[model samples]
Target: MNDEQLMRYSRQIMLSELDYDGQVRLTESHALIIGLGGLGSPAALYLAAAGVGTLTLADDDRVDLSNLQRQIAHGEADIDHYKAQSAAESIGAINHHCRTQVITERLQGEALQHAVEHADVVLDCTDRFESRDAINRACVAAGTPLVSGAAIRFSGQLAVFDVRDSAAPCYACLYGDSGDEDQLTCAESGVIAPLVGMIGSYQALEALKLLSGCGTSQKGLSTFDGLSGQWRHFGLGRDPHCPVCQWRR
Candidate 1:
């Protein structure tokens, strides 16, 4: 690390767990973040500010006026810009030394698999279940750790699914392949801004821990109900019959 780099991450490097080596690992790691809305915004910001070496942001949506309520990565000036591009600009402005890659196309099929395979950590900041499921499958297939988070209304959820641990549960095991919640979305229900910031920031924390090898990751489910300001943590185990991981075993 150069003099500027050292000074840039001085505070984090001061942590006993992150010291010099851990900071180096973080400076050499890459994180793939899906979605550029509520959760993705804060997640991207924190990752960049922390000096993540490379950040590949993927999103096909354009910034909308409504996003100003919680999508902190973009401002009114970015209103018609593609989210991935807008997020990259915001993150770049925060930390010019960090490399930022913007994928303006929506990730799906082979493209999603490629992205997850190359990333040290994958963050699912998306809202739709389908996208989350696809990203989960890719992560499981590549044995990459995933930091997943969601926020809607006054509720938010965060979790880490690390397939590196044989006993850890893949997302499909807990949520099932398909369910009744397909119709639910934050757009219709509305959301509290900080609810996303809280959960997304946690997602960034998990990603950094996974990347730097510096602390215990969530590796399970943690739910937050912001309306009452209550949080819950639960242990999760692999499902012997889960199609995603069953064949691997």
Candidate 2:
């Protein structure tokens, strides 16, 4: 890292837990963030601002006016623009040193697997169950770290899965292969704006932990109730019969 980078990350480097060495690890790491929606917005921006070496931003959808209510990375001008590209521009503006790779299409199959395999950490920020399922399978197959988050209505959820550990539980372990709550989306249920910011920020925190080794990533399942202003943490274990992860066991 250059003098500018040292000054750029001085505050984070001040921490004994994440001193200069940890900052270096962060700068040398790569993170793959799928989706550029509510969750992905803050996750990408925080990671970029924290000096993640490279970020792969993937999303196929274009920005819509309704998205402005929660998607913090996009503005009115970005409406109809591809989300990946818009988020990439925001990342660039926040930290020029942070490199970004924008994929304007949804990634799946071999492409998804390839992206997960090469990343130091993967952040699953998509809304659809199919997208989350595919990402979890890829991460499990590649033994990659995954930081998953979701928010709808007044509830939010977060979980970090280090698939490199055979004993660690994955997203599927928490939500099954085909999650029944497909219709439970912001569009359908209506979400408060800051709820996503809270979840997305936590996802970034977990991703940074995975990359910088500053702290242990979150384990198990964490649920947040915005209405009650309460958080619940529950232990999560692998399912012996989980179709996506059973073979690993």
Candidate 3:
């Protein structure tokens, strides 16, 4: 919008699909990114770099030595530091234009709902099913668009669930919210470093599309198999019995 912003994002503005208008939209958006680990790392950085105006990063966990292998946002000096704090610092280093808000504690109940309500878009980078379920519910209630990404053991998946659309499927529709399913975490099962980076980048891309209105909102499940280097995508339907989104149907 100004001289500095125009020069900073000149290349992006050059794209006809996402020209000056799209860049302005991105600069006016606010995105909430939950988790600051594997998936959150890249998602946060790219969104900041892509000119998302404001970013709220929430994560209570402190950085561990094990995270450096894949959590690119934190450095060796950040070990034992709160992940959200560390990541906010990293984002500031790259884009002074990006206003970064750090939530150093786990967001729950009213706090979670407030965060989702304030955000123009939400990115579910958390690994736990419980956390994912909670985020999905809050987004559904607030009618906020959500970009969810997951990666474990050389595999990753991405999905966008916009509860604002009556026909769109929420995360709960794709994965039941019962929490009875066996959840394999990256810590327990192990994950390739690049796998999460790839998925997280896609999450950032989807968020930009939703905010800037540059591309069509993607509706479906995209799964990536790192072992075979194959990508499979298929449309996901809203489950009539889905506790989170069934009412909309």
Per candidate, the number of residue pairs that clash is 0, 0, 0
Q: Model 2: per-residue lDDT, tens digit, 1-249?
A: 899999999999999999999999999999999999999999999999999999999999999999999999999999999999999999988999989999987799999999999999999999889899999999999999999999999999999999888888888888888787645878888999999999999999999988888888777999999999999999998888888888885
- Candidate 3 positional error at 214, Å: 0.9
Taking all chains together, each candidate's TM-score versus the true structure is 0.98, 0.97, 0.98
Instruction: Give per-residue CA lDDT, model 3, range 92-150, as digits (tens).
Output: 99999999999998998999999999999999999988999999999999999999999
Which pairs clash (backbone N, Cα, C closer than 3 Å) in model 2?
none
Ten-residue region with minimum lDDT total, candidate 2: 178-187
lDDT of 1 by residue, 36-69 (tens): 8999999999999998999999999999999999
> lDDT score, residue 125, model 1?
94
Task: Show where candidate 3 strays beyond 4 Å.
Answer: none
Instruction: Report, for every candidate in turn, its global Cα lDDT versus the true structure.
Output: 0.91, 0.93, 0.94
TM-score of 2: 0.97
Which candidate model has the greater lDDT, 1 or 2? 2
